[model samples]
Target: MPEQFGILTMGDAMITLNPATTGPLRFVANFERKVGGAELNFAIGCARLDLRSKWISRLGKDEFGRVIYNFAKGEGVDMTDVAYVEGHPTSLNIKEIREDGSGKTFYYRYHSPVLTMEPEDITEEMFKDIHIVHLTGVFMAIDRKNLDIVHRVLSIAKEKGILVSFDPNIRLKLWSIEDARAAYHDVFPYVDILLTGRDEIKSIIGTDDDKELADFAQRYSISQLVIKDGGEGSALYIDGQWVRKEAFSVTPVDTVGAGDGFDAGYLYSYLHEFEPAKRLEFANAVGALVTTVSGDNEGLPLLEEVLSFVNQEEVVER
Candidate 1:
C-alpha cells in the first residue's frame, strides 16, 4: 500500500426524485428527493468504511449542487477539488419504481456541469497522496467527450503508480454497447482492478466463459477481476485462481447503489490485503446490506456496522 489510503473519484452528482408510490411517473403524485451519482456513491461508501475518500468534479452553482456537496461532506468524503459552475443547472433524475421493486431512472443531465470539465483540468498534483482512483462507466457513458478526461486521469494514475479500479456500470440509456466497447478497450490497459457485473461483462465483450474471461484479464494485465453476482454472491480472480462467495440474505428495499457499496468493500479489503475469499465475502456483505435500505449511499455502512453484519470480530487490523 502507499503512504496514504486515500481513494479518489470523479463524476457528476444528481438530484434523484423517487416516486412515493409504486407506479409510473405519469401517475405518481408524490416523490422523495435524494442525491445520487455512481462515483459519488462509491466515495461515500469508501468514507463510511474508514477510507479517506476524495472526489473531483464540477457541479452547477445551484441548490441541487449544494445539496450534493453538503451530503457528501456530511458523509466524511473529502471535497477539496469539487467546484461549482455557473449557467448549467445541476443534473436531476426521476425514478419510476414498480410494485416489484424494479425501477427505471430518467436522466436529465443535458449540458451537465461536469461536462464542462476538460482533460487539462485533471492534473498529477490532484492525485497526491491518493492510493487508488476509482472510476465507473456511468460517468464515461454520460458523454463521449468525458472519455478525454478519463484517459488523462488514467495516464496520470499510471505515471504516479497509483492503482486504478474501474466499474463498468453500463447504462445503455447513455450510450450504445459498441461505443462502450470501443472506448473501454482503450481504458483496459490502464486499469489495475476491474469490478464488474456478470451480465455486464457479457455485454461488454460477449463472453462469460471462465477461460475467456481469464484471457480477457490477462490481455489487459489486470491483477484483480471481481464479478458482482448479485443475490447469488460474487466471484473474484486473483493470483492465477478464482474465489467465489455466496451473498448474504436480506430483505431488499432498494437495490440501487448496492454495486457501489460492493466496489468500496472490495477496494477497502484490497487496500488491507485481505485473503481473496475474505474480500469476496466482505464485498458481498456490503452489497447485501445496501439493499436493505432506500436511497443511494444511505445504506452504506460504517466499519462497526459491517463487522457486526458479517459476524466478524470488531478489531480489524488496518
Candidate 2:
C-alpha cells in the first residue's frame, strides 16, 4: 500500500489587495486583505481537498501574524511547525486590479520574520514520515539564510526518500534574472517533480515552446516536468512520455493564484495515482476555475466541484 499523503510546504504568507471597484488609483484605493503566497496557496488548496498539509515558517507577533495563524488553523492546516517571533512584522503584498481583471502586485517582505528562518528550524526528524515536500523559487529570492533553509529541508527530504515537488514560481521583481537562473539550476538537481510556466522558462532558458521546456527539465534529471501555458493549455512529461491538454474556457476575473491552484490540483491528482494525461487535464481545469474569481484561492474548486466541472456536458462555460 502507498504511504498516507501529507505535504510539508515552506514559504512566506502575505496579505493581498483587491480593488473595491473598477477604477484608477486615487489618493487612496479600496483594498481587502487576503492570503497571498505561492506555498500558502498550495497548502490551502490541499486543505480544501481534505489533505494532511502543514505550513512551516516564522510569523511576527503582530496583528497580521495573528490573522494568518488563526486563518490557517481555521482552514484546518497543521500549525505545529509555525514559529512566532517577538519583534518582527508579517510580510505583506499589495495587488492592483483593473476593470478587465488584469493586475500588478508589489511585495514588502524585506526583513520579514519568515526570512529569518535558520537551518536548525528544519530537522531530519521532520521528514521521517511525510509523503511529499513542496517548495518554490520565491523562497530562494527572500534572503541567503532562507535559501539555506530551503536547501537544508530539500536535502533532508531527499535523504528520507520523500517525494520532492518544486515550482519555479519565478518573480522577476524579487531578484535579478542572474540570481534566478543560478538558484534554479542549483535546486533543479534535487527536484523530483518540476512545475514551471512557459513564460518563466522562456525568460530563463530562452524558450517558449513546450517540447524545449520539457526537454530542459529532463536534462536536469527531473523525471516529471510540467509546463503551464495559460489559456493555450499545459504540457506534461512523465516517465519518458509527453502529453498536452487544453484548459477550460472561462472569463478571467483575476489571474493571480491560478498557477498555484494548478500546482495544488496537479499534486492532488498525482498523489491519488491519476494518469499523466488526466493529471494535466485536472490541473488545467483547476487553474482556469481560479481565474473566474477576483481573489487568490477564493475561486479554487473543491474536489467534487472540479470533478463536476470536468464531467459536465459543456466544455466551455460562458
Candidate 3:
C-alpha cells in the first residue's frame, strides 16, 4: 500500500524577476512569482511522469505558503504530510534573470517554518506507505535539529526496507563548506543511491580521480551512483559497471531545477526497472526539456514527451 516515492524537504517558493535590463533589485519592476523548491520540483516532475509522489515539509500559514500548496496540489504531488506552522512566515527567494536565462538568487528564509522542523513532525506512520524516501543535502546541512530529523527519517526508512535516495544539492550560501562536508559523511551510510553532479562529488569527496570515485562508491556500498554533468552528459555506475550518456541538446530558458527533473526521470525509469543506459538517456531528456521553458518545474515533460525527444521524433499525435 506504499506510495511510489516520498520526498523530505523545505519549500522556498520563488519570485523570479525579469527586468528589461538586469541591474539592481530596486530598479526592477517586472516580477513573476512561481512555486519552486528542489524537492517540490522533483515531486512535480515525478508526478508528471505518472508516479505517485508525496512531498513532506513545514510551511508558514501565509499567502506565500498558500501559493506553494495550491501549486503542488495542482501538480498532483501529495501534500498530506505538509504542515502549516502557525506563527512562522513562508520562505521565499528573489532571482533576477537576464535575457540569456542566467540569474542571481537572494533568499529570505531565516525564520521560515521549515527551519524550525523537529523530529516529531516526521511520524512513524508517514513512512509506512512510502517505497522510496528522497532527501537533499541542503536540508540536512541546515542545522543540527534538522540533521537529527533527517537521521531519524533515514533510520525508520531503513528499518522498513525502503530505498533511500539522496541528492547532495549543496548550497554553500546556507552553510559553511566544512559543515556541508561533515554532514555528507554522516548521511552517506544510509544512502542507497546518490544523485549528484561531478563537480560536487569532487568538492565533497575530496577528489575527482576516477579510481578514488570508484573507491568511494564501493566504500559506501552505493547501489547506484549517478554523476550528472550539465549539458555535457551523465554517467551511471551500477552492478560494478559504468554507463555513460550524452546530454540532449536544447536552448535553455532557465537552468534551475533541471537537476531535480533529471532525478525524477531517472527515478521513474528506475521504478520500472529500465536498463542503466535507458535510464540515463531518459534522465538526460527530461533535464533538457526543463531548460526549454522558464521557472523551476514548468518544463517537466510527461512520459510521451520525453520518449519522443529521446527517439528524435516529433509529437505528431497532438
Candidate 4:
C-alpha cells in the first residue's frame, strides 16, 4: 500500500456554542457546545479522508480545552504538538444561525491561548512528515505576531520541498479588510497553492477582472490558484489554463465550515494526482455536503461519502 500523505496546520481551536433556535440570540436560551477552528477543521477534514494530519497550537488547561483536544484526537488528527497553557483561556464563540443558513459568530475570547504560541515555536522538525503546510488568514489575524509564525512555517516547508496551501479566510470580526489584504500579500509569494474565495481575492487584489487575477497569480508565481465562489462553484488556474466547475446542489443547514471542507477535498485530490476537473468536482461535493449538516468539522464527509456523492450515487452520512 502507498504511504498516506501528511499535512500540518496551526491555529486556535474554540469551544463554539450553538443556539437551540435560529434568529436572535437575545431570545435563544439553550446552546450546544462544539469545537471549531479554521486550521483544526481543515486538519479534521483531511484526517476523515485518511490523510495523516498534524496540528500545532496552544489550548488552555481547562475543560473546554480538553474537549477540543480530545475531539480532534478522536477524529484521528495528530495532537502531539498542542500544549496546555497555564493562564491563557481557550477561545469561545456563540453562533447565531439565520433561517437562510447564514450566521454571525460572537467571540468571547479574552487572552487567547494561541497568543502564547511564538514564531520561534515553529521549526523545520515540525514539517518532517508533512506533504503540505496549510495556513489560514484567520490565525494570522488573531494576532499580528502569528504572521511571523506563518512565515516560519512557510520557510521551513519551502526548504523541505513540501507544498504550501493557503486560505485567505477573511474575517472582518477579527481584522479589517485592509489589514487582511496587506498581511496575505506578504505571504502570497511563498504560497504554492492558494485556495481562496473569489470575492476575497478580488477584495485583496482590488480587481475582479479574470485577466488581472491571472496576472496577480503570475506575479506571485503561484502554481495552483483556485477561486472558490459559494454556491456558484469554483474555478482553477494552472499551467496557464483555466478550469471551471459548477457547484453541487444542496440546501445548507449551516455554511460555516464549507470552505475548510472544500480545501481538504481539493488537497486530498491534488495529493492523489486527480485530474483538475475531478478535483474541482470532488471539492464542490465536499463543500455542498458540509452544508447539509451543522457544526464545524462534523459536516466534513469521509472519503467514501465524498466518492458516493461525486460519483452521482446516493449520498449517505456515516
Candidate 5:
C-alpha cells in the first residue's frame, strides 16, 4: 500500500544526557541514545495516529544511521524513501535534560547525509501515493541548496495537487532571522496550512498579535493558520474566523517534541475532515501527550489513546 502522507526532512539523531543535578552538559554523566529530528518526530506521531506516513531523507550508511532507521521503522513509519549514502554518517545532536524540565541542545549536523540532500534526491515515485507533503522551515535554513530543494518539492507537490502543510520550526543557530523571513516569502504561496508556535510566529514574522498573524496568513493565501500558544492554548484561523481552544495540562518529562506532536495531531484531524476547532483540540492533546515521556517521539499516542485522553477516560489495564 502507498503511504498517504509524506514528510520531507532531515534527521538529527540525539544522544541525550540526563541531568542528575540541573546544570551544564559537563556535569551530566549518564546518557540515553534516541532518534530525534523535527520531521522524523512528526512522522512518528502521524504513524501512531494510523496515518500511513512516510519519511523522506538521506540516511548515512553507518550504525548511527541504522539506529535512526530502525527506531523510526519500529515506530511504524515508512522508511522506504530514505537513501543510504556510504561515505557520510548521519547527523548527531547532543541534548541536555535538566531537572526543571528546561533543556539545551547542540547539533553536529554539518556535512551529514541529510544535510547534503540534492534536488534529485526527491522523485515522482516518492509522491505517487502521498496525499499531503509536510514540511518545516528548519530544512530551509540549512543552506541555499536545501532551500532550492524545498522549492522544487513544493512545485512537484503543487503539480500533483497534493496538500502542502508547513511548520516554521525555526532554528536560530541554522540561519539568521533575516534569512528565515526571506525563505518564508518564497515558500508561503505553496502552503495550504501553516502551523506555528506563537513565539516562532513572532520570530519569523516579527509578530505575535492575532490581527497581524491573520493578515500575514491572508496575504500568503494560506487557507488555514494554526497558532500554538504554549500553556495558554491554541487558536485556529480559517475563513477569516478565529477559533480558540485551550491546552491540555500535563507534567512534562521532556518537552522537546511537543510541537511536532501537535502537527501530527492536527494533520490526523485534517485527514479526517474534522472541524477547525476540533482539530485544534486534538492537536493540543497530542502535544500534551508527547511531553509525558522522555524521548522526542516516545509519547505520541495512537488514535484510541488520543480519543481516550480527549474524553478523560481512565485506563484499567487487564
Candidate 6:
C-alpha cells in the first residue's frame, strides 16, 4: 500500500578493523571488512525487516568499492542509484580496539569519491517509489557540494509527500562545533522525524534533560522526536504525547553501530504502525544485540529473531 515501505538512505561506506586479542595494544589485529555507515546501516536494518531500501552515494570504481557495492546488493538493498566515479577511491575507517573492549577510530575519508557527490546525481524521478528519505549529519561534513546534494534530495522528497528522517550522528572529528550547529539548524525545519542521542542533543542544542530536549524539538515542529540514551534507554515524543523505554541488559562486546541499529529498528516498527512504546523497546533490543557481535551489521538480528526475543521477554519492549 505504501510503495513497499521504501527507504532511501544517504551516506558513505567504509571498512573497519579490530584487535585480535583481549590483552594488550601491541597484539595482532583481527581485520574484517564490513560495510559501515550510519545511513547505510539503517537502510540494511530496514532491509532485514523486509523493507525495500535504497542507498544513495558515490563509490569509486575500485576493489573496495566493488566489495561495498556487492555487500549492499547481497543484503537486498537497491544499489541502482549508486554512482561509480572514475578517479576517486572509496573511504575507509580503521577501528583500533583496546584490551578492555574500548576502541578508537581513524578515518581516511577526506576527498573520497563519496564527498564528490553532486546534486545532479539524484533526479526527481528517484522519489517516485520512495516512502521515506533518511539523512545523517555526518554527510553534512563532507563538503558544500555534497551537502547541497543532500538538501536537494530532502527537498524533493518533502515535495513528493515522502517522509523525511534525520539522524544527527555527530562526529566532532569531521567539522567544527560551530559548523555542526549551523548545518543542523539549516536542515531542522525540513525534518519530519528527528532521531538523535541525548549526548548529541547536549552537544548540538546545549541541553541535557529529557523534557528540555523534547521541548526544543517541539519548538521546531518536528512530528516525532526520539532521544536515545545508551544503557538508560530512550524517550519518545509524538503529537504532544511522551513515553520512556528502558534498554535491554546485555554485555556489549562492541558498541560501534548500536545507535544506527536503534534508528533502523525504530523506523522499521514505526512504518508498520507499531505502538511507540513497543517501537522503543524493539529499537533498544536491536541496538543491544548488535553490540553482542564484532562488526556493525554482523550482529543485527532478523525480524523473526527480534520477534522471538520480544515474545520470550529475553528482551523487553517497555
Q: After superposition, how far is residue 241 of candidate 4 from its true place, in Å?
A: 1.0
Give residue 65's lDDT in candidate 1 (0 to 100). Answer: 92
1 or 4, which is superior by lDDT? 4
Better of 4 and 6 by lDDT: 4
Of models 2 and 4, which has the larger lDDT? Answer: 4
Global CA lDDT of candidate 1, please?
A: 0.90
The worst-scoring run of ten residues by lDDT in candidate 3 lies at 8-17
* Candidate 6 lDDT, 1-318, residue by residue in tens: 554688888888876555455544456556666678777788788888788989888888899889888988999999888878888888888766665656677888866888667788789877767878889988888675667887898789878989989998888898888898898998888898899998888899898776786788788888989988899999898878789998888888777778888888888888888899998998988888888886778777787777877676544332
Q: Compared with the true structure, what per-residue lDDT tens digits does model 1 show for residues 1-318?
A: 544389999998899997899978899999889999999999999999999999998899999999988989999999999999999899999989898867788999999999889999987889988999999888899888999999999999998999999999998899999999988899999999999999999999999888898899999999999989898899988878888999998889878899999999999988988899999988998898889887787888887788887985453332
Q: How far off is residue 166 in model 4, in Å?
A: 0.5
Residue by residue across 1-318, what tens digits does model 5's lDDT show?
633554444334433333455667888776667777888888888888888888888778888888888888898888887877887767778776567767777887777686667888788787877778989987777666788788889999999999899998888898888888888889999999999988888888887888998899999999999998878889998999899999898887767789999998998888878888899999999888888877767787787888888889963121
lDDT of 4 at 29: 89
In candidate 1, where is summed lDDT lowest over 10 consecutive residues?
309-318
lDDT of each: 0.90, 0.82, 0.80, 0.91, 0.81, 0.82
State in Å the error of residue 27, model 3.
0.6
lDDT of 4 by residue, 145-233 (tens): 88888888888888888999999999898899999989998999999999999888888888767788889899999999999998899
- For model 5, the superposed segments whose C-alpha errors exceed 4 Å read 1-23, 97-102, 315-318
Q: Estimate TM-scores for all models.
A: 0.95, 0.92, 0.93, 0.96, 0.92, 0.92
Score candidate 1 by TM-score against the native.
0.95
RMSD of 3: 2.4
Taking the tens digit of each residue's C-alpha lDDT, what string does model 2 give over 113-200? Answer: 8866889889776665578899998888888567788889989988888989999888778889888898888888899998888888
Collision pairs in model 3: 2-129
TM-score computed on alpha carbons, candidate 6: 0.92
**Model with the higher TM-score, candidate 4 or 6:** 4
Checking candidate 1 for backbone clashes, the offending pairs are none
